[model samples]
Target chain A: MRGGAIAILAWATVLLVLFIGNWIWDAKPVNAATAAFAAVVTYATGVALWLARREALRPGPPAPRSEPESVPQSSLAAVLIGLSVGTILFGLAWANFLVYFGAGILVLSLGRLVLELRSERATRRRLLGEEEPR
Target chain B: MSVATAPRARLARRGGWPEALTSTDHKQIGLNLGACSLFFFLLGGVFALILRTQLAQSNMQVLSDNSYNEIFTMHGSTMIYLFVTPMAVAMATYLVPLQIGAVRLSAPRLSLAGFWTWLAGGLVMESSWLTADGAGRTGWSSYVPMSNSTNTPGVGQDLWVIGVILVALGLTAMSICVTVTVARRRAPGMALLRMPVFTWTALLSVLMIVAAFPMLILAMTLLFIDRTGAGHIYTGFAGAIDYQDLFWFFGHPVVYVMFFPYLGGAAEAVAVNAHKRWFGYTAFVVSIMMFSALSMAVWSHHMYTTGGVTNQYFAFTSTLLLVPAGIEYFDMIGTLIGGAIVLRASMLFALTFFLQFLVGGLSGVFVASPVLDYHAYGTYIVVAHFHYTLFAGSIFGFFAAAYHWFPKLTGALLREGLGKLQLAVMVIGTNLTFFPMFFLGNDGMPRRVSRYPTHPEWGTLNLLETIGAGIIALGVLIFLINVIVSLRRRIVAGDDPWLGHTLEWATTSPPPPLNFEAPLPPVRSYAPLLDLREQQLDRERRLEGAPA
Candidate 1:
């Protein structure tokens, strides 16, 4: 929607001001670093949104859409990827062999995730083609 | 022009656990996350009961010191990381898209992955109990020096550190999805400001989560490395103070992360039951932004006694928070005045949330002052203060949401009578359990102790608190029973039960996979359904007045 980037940017500016105040008052390196990092991350997100669409910074509701949107029903690859990461971390604390096993799963899941994305794009294309007036 | 939905082709429509676990639908993901959070809530409650039992009388020896330490740490950790914060996210994930008339979340697959990762983190954290030593005993904050490799060395603590990292990582990923959805997925007319009250609150919450949670991940990851002797990353006095700074940076905003969504839910419940649009909508939105921003800046208030930070700066920021806090209360009161107020269970809980949170907020102001905090810190007063806020306040708001949205979530109305009874019992139990701690804390009783030397007043109050904890448990049990009985009886809730004001009510109860099956009502205002009703009423009035 319009102004989404503006809102984020505005809030990030407020955080930056607060962080500046913190730096001036406390001057502790760790505290300053933490505040600075948060501010930067927020500002970076705002900038990314702005760059994605200039309209995101303008003020109004979004325009009505005509494009078809793909909605995936299920993503087993996503679940597997999540479990793999968790398993890899858990293995670090518990066992070494499990880490290798989780890595293998992660690789397979990534491949499946690519397949899902390609399929989703094809579904969107099909929907668009069906709607094209012959 | 209407938005068009593309059909799924290749994905198999499987049922049972596979579908439940792998579904990328925001609603399903939300429900899965919420169910897990509720389970953690009961788990956390059991931990609370154990703590209360141990503290019932001085030198009771209900559990050994080490065991007590583990229980208390897990109690705080489970409730914050697993229950309250995740519940807020679950509510937002499930309802924000529906409320804003979005078809689905941005990055749905990522959100699903986040859910699984978070669940695994919780399991890993709890699995610490099965270890040779025990679960984490260094408290939820897990400061350095005290939590260093030499002092509190164990695999359990290591697992806790890793678990916290995963939880933070997962929550961050999910929060990013919510944030992106809000920014990009609004219905045609649902502008940034015109998004419903709950969506605004949820937006702020996810933003805060995105801005703050990474610090926790960094803090935990470094703690793990420090614990494993990879590096003396946190060393000496500076290390301790640095760790606190890092932890509380995430820590303080998290309190609001646990709060804002529930507050939004309660606000919606109040407005709907009162049969009025939310009061001072622009002011309310602005205040929450200020409130959340101030919350991030005030983290060092927790470190005031440590003498490593500027007390005045933090205190000033913390005190400034009262301004926004006051605005919200004023808006709530303004909304209630001269409206068609209904004393539904949800409405009562909403009112109770405001009242109980006032107690917590006022107490917070006291501790926000360095002079006052010098006396209150590490005492039962601090414990009482936060419990009033987090438990009495946020949990009550959560219930308000539950009661208001239960129909929408499940297509069944929860038994009102049982709900009212549960509310009554919970209120009494909550007050009884937490109120006495203020008195006990003022009398110089320190917190985090398994045993204390016997004094009549302390003993009696602790006993009262233990009994109150039991009563609270009973109240929760009543609620569970109410849920079961209501679901079984199946009091079918129609599409627009309670004449709800938002876009979500325009759809069927337990909404379709795409959220809305019908074209969304024109979002001329935040409450599109209310706008439609008012327009209809105006038309009827004009026709009646005309000289036909």
Candidate 2:
């Protein structure tokens, strides 16, 4: 839910700013359309992530001990990148302009951020002793 | 503490050559890294000589652009993938397990795989020139449009891509293993605070490796697809700026991978040689974390003149890098303040690192500005600056680690007096070789060109640089001799040589399968061994005070 809210806020911001940008610069039809479709896809993905974020890393204090937990950052990055790129190039290629750009940016931003946040929690746990939770 | 509980109680006293080579041991891993890094060091040094020989005369027709490309590429690959990373990785692999007082590296089998993969990767990357693409003239970062499929047509680029991705994977696997081992396998009393500085740096390096490398592999995969017609990676079919985004994302962190461990090694050496605690311990830790974060943000600095995102924002972040860089230097200085300096080979390297890396960092501050980058971007000055910072600064620090720990790894002492002499020559030589490139860059001499129009002024500086290069070569030769003669002699160093400040030195010089019998000390400060030494010294002083 928090992830969805964050994505929505970011998409609305990208859309509003770009709409005003297009209004000011008189952006080409393709670019304007790109901005709109991008926004919608961003929202959709955000909802999906919010629904599924539970299956990802459980938000908690980092590792339960001082020993290093081997967080598989690489495997996660590879899979997310493959999916995001695949979505942009194929699935979203012919989608509305807003869908393509919005989905791409959303996945790039939210997806990476969420993974990073999970890793951040894990790293913090490793770095700071989980002697107690705040 | 009894002999029964010792690590060697489980293994043999000695193993033969074939047995050692096939051994799934951390000790073997260390030896493998050391030997291979040394060999690549010599190979890179030879390439440097070829480059210097060509540059010895400008417009001389001695080497073509393609030739220069191959030479510099091999030189760079050798230094980055082979020399610097391997040496530090070796130091960490050899020392971290020992420092943590573990039975063995967490994944010794994966470690062997990493070594073999690294060896293969280096060979493949170096041999890319012999392929139809004639090696990547796009340089090490291989930034796009030029590195893109449209301009650079060749299997060589594809080979370069494959080689580097493999190497990155190898490093990632090794570092992840190290992280797991350090986390789960420490001796009973060892705490996070008690970990050695080298181990700490290794952990940070491992984290950066796991996080940063997938981007490179992905970027390379895209490029590979573009070449094979699977997908448009760098070309505009997919997007134009994508390559730059991904490359710098990984490339910038790659720079940290090159220096951070050496920086860690230097920190460890300086603290012990000065016989004082690392100053501002908590600040150093914070700076390490900050440096890692900033490393991610500052990737855009490489693209400053390209006009993609916010150049000003990147410049600000780039300039902010100085804070952590400064804090690290200050901490080293703090260790030296009011402390008796031992001035060992390691200390010499650390001092040089402080001075030279500051120059690199400070110079970068000037370059970080968009205005300055417009004038100086892509110039030899940029080359000189990085060499000073990374090669002179970090590479020198790595040499220090090698010399400092060689004794412990091999159960022998290096010729310390010779080590100091070679270290000084290396310092002077490195400065002479790279410092003037700043002026050349300011004067607008660009990088990647084979020849220059000789003016008496430029000629003098070039000659001086050549001389410096020769001096550096001499220093390297001296290092080779030091390793060879000492290891052959095996002069008994015992454990705890130099009154070392980490748990690694607590074990025998050439430790057995396990590092230590007891758990590690509580790591609140930088130097746990110093803590142990002080505690022991205090006990002696107290016992003498008591009725004896």
Candidate 3:
């Protein structure tokens, strides 16, 4: 992750320059506001990365690593959540009953997602415990 | 490199449909996204052929005017949203992790969700054709005032808006994952500058997506609200201009989003086939950064004729794009100079991509001028310009990627003979189909019209374009056949078939679940494998000089 923050910040700076130019020359509220919002989002992303890891702002390659982490093989809940959102939006354009149906599925999927995540965390914990010295 | 094994033990293993549907593997997600995008590409191509048939001759009644409008709208929408944009993301999702030596994507489950959401959006959009009102008849841009309920009223139009919102949301979600992955997931020694050319391009594309796609989602959502009578958001002249500004902000960047990744693909193909590292690697990187940033500032150029934008500012930014574009061409030439050149299918496609995109770029310079744009604004010249860039340029580059990577993806070689044939036919068909439009537009033929008056050369040119469309379809058929034949015959491609420079080639063909089964080669440079090869050559020379 070394230099990650710098890259994002550099891009954000470019956007900021363009945003200022737009603000001065075009001066349309929507145009200026859109440009500003984009710059803010990019800056926020860079700042968040920097805050997460101070080394993200440092220049160089990352240190080599050997770390154990859980990788999910599959997740049905994720697919359901996505479909439910699409359904709710489509229902707004097509039928009212589908909205309720989609909302029901969304709640169920969220619950299922929580359970899946909990199970993944447990698995990770078990692996780490096994790796510890006796 | 260690992964928790307990999760596999805890979760039941499934295969076939269930596994394909629910797998969190980035490779699977990328494949699913790509296969669906290909299907949509074919669907959009059919729509294009239908339009071509209707315009084959003056006053041809192949389709009703309304039908023509719907087909044209769907054609642009399907190609842009469902095919090209997502395909770029699909390539990044699959290849970026492999290129950067990551074990997996940053958020696999979220990427799967994104895939499903995008597919659902595509389905919903296409389902509009089944509605009683036919389909969304407005152009893909669907400018406000005209797209309002009074002028264009129907469930189909509303459905189009909703579909667009969903697609934008899905693409944005997926793009965020890629951005985060690049930020957090590179292997040790794979510094930002040491990342592969394609990975850099993908990073810029996803960054643009994260920055611009929300504006699109917001625009579409407000349009839907306005259509549903919730509010009159776009009510005045200023509102109309506001809508255009917002749309073009996304619209213009999306063009580069579609181009940059394909450009990277073509660049890689060229470097590999030439037996040389990419020339001007650092300059190429800086140029694309400038290229991408200028892409954002040039959005207002699309609105120049509207008279509500600062034309001079936009025109200047739009024209400034040529500097970086010229640098890329120069880099390509530098790479080609005095290198061991191979005339492989992928190399040919890469060369064609550069040659054809030049025409598009030069035409862009002409149209970037406000004075010149006033003449070419709504004509077929604009149509020709974009087709050269998007279809002729990007599609050629896409084929270059496919031919170059099919072996790595499938552990098999595509039929080179068939590939060459397809490339030649496509090149002919593409130029024949789009090149004449420049002349037709110069003669004042407008776009989005189903028929034109019988002029001396208009009928002949339209006839040639229609024939060219068929030829392009034939070329695509040749490609499909090549894929089927190659996959079935099964000429096994081992790891590092092309002696590739990137990390993806350092592993098994098609890769394992974790991408690399063996330890990664030390990533000392962007082209680590190339460095290894050169070191071995130097060692052999030393041994020969020792007189052993």
Candidate 4:
């Protein structure tokens, strides 16, 4: 995974260099904007990757973790959040009331998301407690 | 800590339609996305059939010019925005985690949310047909001033703008999640270069999406504003050029976004059936990175004929693409050389994918030149080039993936007989449908017109294309029948049916809720399973040599 980050960074660097060339050669505003956006995204992602793990900057293989991980099965809040976003956007083009309706639903879904996260954390803690040495 | 003391025995509910709809499981989200994509594919295919019918004979009254324009626009939009691009994300969402030996997707909820957002966007786009003015009638690119409210005034055009914005948003979100999952979830010792070929391609694709999709979202938003009379955002020649610049930035890279994953799938199928690791793995990776970069840089080549963009720079970048593309062909041939090869349905499709895409790529070289593009732009030659790449190239690669991964997704093998028949039909149909357009294009037939003057050879060629379109439809029907038949009377495929190299094959067919139930094998190289096989064979040979 760390290696993947470095690879992306390397690719990003190449794109950034090419972007500079594109800028100097023909200074089209749109071209400069696109190049700038791509460069910033790549650079920001590289920084994020480095922050996530400094080793991403100099990677070979990922370090293994021995701990058991708990994975959730489903989330209703997620589904609602998705539907609400679509509804809000669709409403913007189609009807006004739907936009408000979607926003309300979105708020409720976010609240539900919090609850779901809390439940997941509780389950994880209990499982961890059971696995601890007596 | 207080929350930890609360009820921890509560489990997420399971088993029902609601569960199916709301499930955050990456596999479910992927399958859902795929199902929707297939539905859109059929709808888009119907649109194409109608279009071909209209074009079968000169000045046919099958559809009015207005209706014809709408259908063609919808056809291109449905296929590009709904089917191919989302399908790429679908594969990534499903396979990336399993390939990397992760139990769940990173940000699974976000992925689920993205799926619905995208699905809703597809529905809204289609819903434009119900409008009083009809659907978005501009070509899929929807060039401004023409697409401006003054020119194409309608609720439908507004819907189209909003639909594209939502689609971009959804796909972008999902792609980011896939990228993060690949970046964070790889199993220990699975170095980046040692990752499976498919994962590497998927990673590159999602990264390209991350870089490019924002431009699309911004384009659609501004287009919406331009349409709604908020401001005369795109006014004159400069405005049109600016629109093209923005549109093509997303537009060109989106082509590769649609290509790379299926290319990965085909490459994997070829390598597995050839009984070898992919040849030139490091070179292949570097080539794809260059390919993606060059693709981004080459966006203005699409705008070269407009004379707004730097023709030489774009041409250079576009022509340079041949380098990476040529290396890919070389690597594929190298993998097939001196190897025990099997002509399975998957392998056949994969091989054909390469052979057919070459036609598209070579034709693309013709248009990359400024002089040639002036002749080819807005003609059927351009149409033929893209259809070859997208349909003949990507769709075939997609089927190779379907044949390769179907057994893993469902615990049954697709019927080999039906698979081969479908491939044969599609190959014949696809060429018949698109190959003639090259001649028509060269001979000076303009595109996006509902009618043409009754020229002698033109009618005959168009008739052939129409017939070919029907054959393509028949091929798709056969594939559907094959899938249904395979599922009903199942031949149970156990884990690792193809002796697959990736971690996904290490799990059970139709993997369990958390993907893998057993501990994963040691991550030795890119082809970990193949590594295990070689180690066992070496051990057996060593034992036989020892004195008993």
Candidate 5:
């Protein structure tokens, strides 16, 4: 749930700023086509990532307790908030820069999820080694 | 085992080079192949640098078009046929048996025969380079009409035709040995999936060569027959592109055949250097197989702009090629995804290869689109594209594997710092040189031209490219220096310096006439040596706790 919320807020903040930046750059506003393309890519990727992360954190999942000792959820939430707020600030005038940063974070977030999965696998292997064989 | 060595046990080292030449021992044969391939590798590299230097500038004729053609042809022919293929074959004959618990290659005599034929063919091809018409001027692809007698004259091209067919025959013979050894000689417990990825790649490579080279032989023979005026085979209604169809029937798959071993070599090297098991061994192996099969289907991609071929069909196949190619990317990235990353000379080369081959592969995708193919085909863009594929994909893989295995082959570690410097320069110089050609090609520079006409605004890119060529030459020279110095001054590396898991590391630094005394036991996992190391640590810990 938290992952999805973070992803939505982050995605919206970045998109809103980029749209406004185009608003400022053009005589009226940037065309629907280019902005639409970027928005569609960003939003789809963001939502997918958020849903995946939220599924991982759900109580019934095998990894329900996996994040318990890792990073504090509150801190992750704080970081997400800061990024969302910063995007809202610079999203207009610095639309290009925001796009780069947002895309990077998007990719990095996906990578972190992957690394978490790998670590879980490694842990299961170690745990298997510790158990007595039948 | 005791048949031949008993006689020469006393007088063996006396004949030295001669004994090595006449040796039927698998190791000596391997050593010979390794040494000769190394010699040719450097030679091909020099040809490449010289050609690059020529194309670096607009055209004062450091070399003419024909000379450029010969140099490029020989460069490719030398690297793929003489150097890389034979080297891999040699490694297979020498190492795989040891790794697989075999006493020797399936038939050592056939291997020796293969070697002699290969050496002779290499000599014949090399000699043609010095001849009047100057050695197979029709590019390595040697497309028809251009390669046809009506267009190209002289015995030199004929010799290339004959020599390649001969070498291809020899390679076919060697491939059978490799296949039999793998199939028959693996340790009792080693199943197909359990075989090392290198061996898997080797087996697949030999298979490709066997199937494809026969077609190449058939094509070359038809051409040879036409040249002698025996029949009007290529002289008929289809003319040269018929030969193009026939040749690329062999030509396109041959590219991956030459490269797959290097790719296999790189995968193994990356696993060894990373000190972790390859992340997805099965996926990686499957990807190689995918590339091999998909490779044949996509040959028409090369014919996209060949004037009369259907662009629509070629473009469709080329795009479909991306799936298998992308799977390889997935496997490659997966291999390194979570392992402990070690940034050594070999690892650095592997990483750079990943970066460069990705770009190269992507550009290949771009060229696959029919519209783009229409614009870029026959231009310098195509040259830029393949050079990227060859250098970044194949040659870079070669350097990574060579540096990684140099110790195992020679019992000496290459100077790592120098190796890294050479790799960096190569990476930088390669991009600087070839990247601009994409622009030049887009701006309307045709390949195979000595001088650009005054109009195209090609001056600056050409100049920049030439400068990069010089740097690349220096970088390659540095690699040569590393090899030379390592011969005398380098640190001695015993077997298993990198903790290699396969059976090759189960013997001495430089193994004797026979690679091993007892065959290595099979493994449940790829990292047999790692398991051994962990066991040793556990034993030591237990010993320390004893009440002694």
Candidate 6:
């Protein structure tokens, strides 16, 4: 994790150097703006790493996690959500009815996703409880 | 210490055809994505064959000009958007979790969703063919003014724009997931530097995707709106330049995005077959990061001849690409030096990948100079240059990876004899097909044209290229047959074939639902299994030396 943070920061630094170089040479709004966007993405990723664990910023190994994770085997909602987004976007160009149809499916999928997450959480809690006293 | 909860056992039991379509497991998603990408590759190849047939002789009018335009456009689009880019992601999604010793992806469901989104996007884009005007006839880049509704007005073009947006959006989502998984879900001892070579490459590739794909989505979305009469955003010279700026920002980095993961795969194949750990691992890592960053900065090189860009700046940054590229080549050579090199099919493909990419890289260096680019831009030389890089280079690396990992993915080995034969045919066919284009371009042959005026040299070269295209198709046919034969024969490859170096080899072939079943061995370095083997050898030597 620490190394991942450092790597992101390192890449961000490379981007910053290039960004400055591009800015000084031409300074076109489009060029500068795109370069800036790239830098922001790099920095944000670094920050996300930091937020995930303070250990990501420190020179050490990741702390071993004891809790067993509940890995989902399948998610029909996920599949529906993906297809619906594509359908809605395709509908934007091709036909209007698909847009409404896709939006409806998207809403239903989101609801189903929430339920799946809840069930997953409950399963994790039950497993942790079984292991707690042992 | 970790104890994995087996809560999904029941679901795993039902992993039939239906589960494969909706599975949140990284491996399943990766396989599905990869299989779909291969289908797209075949489709694109057919388009290429047809285009080559049209261009076989001077002034041949087998297909109309507009139909030729649509074929070439879809060919490029399918190869880039649907095949190579997604295939790279597929490899990473399938392998990264195993390489980093994670049981599952950080957001498994998100990864599943991304795969479907990308698939749907591909389908929608292809569906453009059903429209009255046919598929997106504009080139894959679809430069504005020319691509604007005023010039190329059609629902097909509109659908192309929408499809591109969705593809970028979906890949971006998946890339973010992979990025976070690397940042957060690595095993306790699998520090970032200790991660396998492919994982690092995948990391950098996804990082570039996270940074650049958004620009693609934004550009295409604006283009879609502009097409729908919302605004005339890309109008004159400035508008055209702005559109190029936005599109190329994604365009150029995507070449590297298409290259790096396969480079990682080839590097692994080379190192493993050579019986060596990767040479200069730290330097390789640094170079790839620098390489990717530099690629992002050099997009304007494509626009230099347009006279609207800062040629000097672009040329400088573009030429600087040679440095990192040189480091990678040197690393490959260093890995091979004084090592027990085995010419396995995977190794041969890997070696060929490096060698062929050099031709592309050298040609790129020629075009990097603004003076040379003036002559080369919009010519067959440019066409030849990219095909060498994107197809000859990346496809070889892709095959190397497929050969190396097919056993792990399917619990069976691909036949070496057939694999080698395919490689030989492909090498001959690829070179024969694309090499003469360089000469054609130098002789003032233009690209993307359906017909050509009679010229002895141009006509002859076109004929050769058409023949080469047929040979390449035959090679692909053999490969498909090999796959069918190998699967039926089923030469079961057990866990740890080739005495693999990564953590993946520690698990079963076609690994279980949770990836690893037993406790993972100690993670001391990038090649943990290799480290384990060396330690065991040392212990045996010490025991042999002791008094008994």
Each candidate: how many clashes? 0, 10, 0, 0, 1, 0
Residue pairs in collision within model 4: none
Per-residue lDDT over B473-542 for candidate 1, one digit per residue giving the tens place of the 0 to 100 score: 9989988999888677677777888999998898887788888777777778888889889988888888
- For candidate 4, what is the DockQ-based docking class? medium
Question: Judged by DockQ relative to the true structure, which candidate is superior, 4 or 5?
Answer: 4
List model 3 lDDT by residue over B1-548, tens digit each.
Answer: 11111112111134776887788988888888999999999999999999999989999999999999999999999999999999999999989999998989988888888888888899889989999987888989999999999988999998888889888888888888887887777777677788899999999999899999999998998999999999999989988999999999999999999999999999999999999999999899888988988898889888878889999888888999999999999999999998899989999999999999999999999999999999999999999999999999999999999999888787778888999999999999999999999999998999999989988799999989999999999999999999888777767777787889999998887777888778777777788789779878888988889532
For residues B1-548, write the lDDT of model 4, one tens digit per residue.
01111111011224766777788888888988998999999999999999999999999999999999999999999999999999999999999999988888999888888888898889999999999999999989999889999899999988988888888888988998998887677777676778888888898888888999999898888888888778778889999999888999999999999999999999999999999999999999999999998888888888877877778888888999999999999999999999789999999999999999999999999999999999999899999999999999999999999999998987778888898999999999999999999999999999999999999899999999999999999999999998887777777777788988888999987877788888788787888889888878888888899532
lDDT of 2 by residue, B1-548 (tens): 11111122122245555445545567666677668877888998988888877776567576888889878877887788778777767766777878776767766656655665666566666667677658756777776667766777776776676677667766766776676666655554455545667777776676566656777777777776776677764655225456766667667767887788888888878887887777887677667766765675566678777665557656766887888888888888888999888988888887888788888887888788889888889897788878987888888888777767876776677778778888888988898889888887888777878888877667777777788899899998888888777756556776777788877877776666555555445543446668767878889988899532
| Model 5: pairs clashing at backbone N, Cα or C within 3 Å | A17-A91
TM-score of each candidate structure, all chains considered together: 0.96, 0.78, 0.96, 0.96, 0.74, 0.96
DockQ of each: 0.54, 0.03, 0.55, 0.52, 0.01, 0.60
Candidate 6 CAPRI-style tier: medium
Task: At residue B93, give the lDDT of candidate 6.
Answer: 91
Model 2 lDDT tens row, A26-121: 333433343344344434434543553322223221233354444221223323332333233322212356347646654674566577557767
What does each candidate score in C-alpha RMSD? 4.2, 11.4, 4.2, 5.5, 22.1, 3.9
RMSD of 5: 22.1
The candidate, 3 or 4, that scores higher on DockQ is: 3
Best by DockQ: 6
The digit string of per-residue lDDT tens for model 6 on B12-71 reads 347678988888888888888899999999999999999999999988888899999999
Fnat (0 to 1) per candidate: 0.60, 0.00, 0.60, 0.63, 0.00, 0.74
Per-residue error at B76 for model 6, in Å? Answer: 0.1
Considering lDDT, which of the candidate structures 1 and 5 is the better prediction for this target?
Answer: 1
Per-residue CA lDDT of model 6 for A1-134, tens digit only, reads 44467788889999899989989998899889999999999999988876776342222334556878898988999999999999999999999999999999999999999999999999999999999999
* Candidate 5 lDDT over residue span B1-548, tens digit each: 01111112211454566566666666766777777888888788788778767765566678877788888888878887788677777766666776665556765555665676676567766777666677877777777767777888887887777667667766777777776666555554455566677777776676566556666777777887787667887764366656766667567767776677777777777877777667677776666665665565455567666564555655665676677677766766776777777888988887777778777788898898878888888898988888788776777887887787777666777888999999989988898888998999998798877667755458778877878877777888898899888766657777777788676777765665556554454355555556667667888888899532
Residue B286: error of model 3 in Å?
0.9
DockQ of 2: 0.03
